[model samples]
Target: MPQPGATSRILVTGGAGFIGSHFVRSLFSGAYPGLAGSRVTVLDKLTYAGNPANLDPVRDQPGFAFVEGDITDAGLVDSLLADHDAVVHFAAESHVDRSITGAADFVVTNVVGTQTLLDAAHRREIGPFVHVSTDEVYGSIAEGSWPETDPLAPNSPYSASKASSDLIALAYHRTHGLDVRVTRCSNNYGPYQFPEKVIPLFITNLLDGGKVPLYGDGLNIRDWLHVDDHCQGIALVLEKGRAGEVYNIGGGTEITNKELTDRLLSACGATWDSVDYVEDRKGHDRRYSVDWRKINAELGYEPRHDFESGLAETVAWYRDNRAWWEPLKQRAGLA
Candidate 1:
């Protein structure tokens, strides 16, 4: 696998979305020392979750470009890959509830789109393709944490599609010998996240004196990782991860949904009166935890943001950036 340097030309899919935009901004801002001067071309479909404003902070940085396009377009992907040395794939339909209601989009974007990108990368001889993935691919873990070696047992259509993409990505490395590295990360919460996601949704709702729905008993547990830390782990993987290997990135903080809701309520100056218990999501995982020791030992990856402080900061961001999210919520009919 070829290593990326300052002069490397990298393609980032879904760079207008929350996590992808953060990565692009970090790249241009020199957050990743190994990729300080790397050139970046972002190919995004500008889906509902993908807000162009997310990249506004670094839009004019030298060596940065953005192309509005879909990854499923084989010709487009191929043409773009020809100019890039590596790829960091983040495009996917990731909302579990939305996937349950309609799964075809998830399959097309997560599976077919991934296959299309991988094929293009292989043809273009692009090395070190980093596939960003989720820990939900392991399904519900009752106890302990899932290591990178765990068999994928995805429960939701969204996770299933992501799992399929993960396998397809690895298969390319195994059979065609593409330089593919996969990173499975825990739940992410931070600024610039679309309001449809849990953290932002709840924050925005509560800010408007609206009620938040707590599914089932709200006992479902999830490990939360700040977007910054998640991106840090990804940068480490892109810089030093071994090809064909999977790494789990965790924040080392586990909290039940009910507990999380309580914290959110407090953060937003709301009481339990603002909470409404709702039916649980179909096939909702009971808990999710990832063993991130592999990345820590291999790439010196460790989450820098504490959960309490991270959550508080996230709430503050949504509160302060209503101009950024209000229109998004109205456009998505989520308000």
Candidate 2:
């Protein structure tokens, strides 16, 4: 395993996106004790969801570099892997709504792009290639949470592609002896997030005095995870996780969509009047919950952020950072 130190050079794919950017910022800010002083190279394609301004905080930090490129490009991926000791992959076509409208992009980026990166890492003899994934790959659970060993039952194209990538990532470890670690996390929300996801979307909309959409009966349940906590778990997996293993990282806070909307409305000083009950997303999973005991037992990982405070902070961030998210919303036609 490659140890985290000053000499460590880590390649972070999708480092300009929401969750990935959080991880990159943490690495540079001494937030991850094990990875302190490690050099980081951010590889981002500057997609619609990726904003270069997201890395502005650490843009000029020592031992930090940014590359604008595609992960599916073998030449670029191969060249970047040559100089890096390890890779933390977060690149993907992640929005389920987008995937439902078009599946090709999801397959290309999530599945093929991952395979390309894995192949390059394998060729370069890289150690500890951490694959960041989602609990959605396990599909919906009616009651109990999903463990690391549970069978994958992804529902949407977005999740199916992620599930495919997860399997291929593990196959590299099993078949080629490449050191690979996988982490599946629940829903993430935090600052610098593009205003497309539910939390950010509703927050921005409510901030603008617009109506928020409540899909179906607003009864769908999801476990909310703060992006900081998610990144912490990924850092743990990157540092000490066993090769060929899957870890489930969760926030342990589960609530119905109706409940979440109520909270967002309260946070934004709005009421149920601003809500629009819409059709539920096609093939939407009723509830998602992950049993994160495995990661906790092995890595001493536990979420430190309180959901109430975290949600409040997230709302405050969007409310106060209109200059950051307004342009993004306008460009995406959400404004």
C-alpha root-mean-square deviation, candidate 1? 0.7
Residue 318 deviation, candidate 1, in Å?
0.8
Off by more than 4 A, model 1: none
Candidate 2, residue 308: lDDT: 98
lDDT of 2 at 233: 97
Candidate 2 stretches with Cα past 4 Å from truth are none
Weakest 10 consecutive residues of candidate 1 by summed lDDT: 1-10
Q: What is the model-wide C-alpha lDDT for candidate 2?
A: 0.94
lDDT of 1 by residue, 1-335 (tens): 45889788999999999999999998888889999889999999998899899999988888999999999999999999888999999999999999999999999999999999999999988999999999999999999999999999999999999999999999999999999999999999999999988889999999999999999999999999999999999999999999999999999899999999999999999999999999999998999999999999999998999999999999999999999999999999999
Task: Extract clashing residue pairs from model 1.
Answer: none
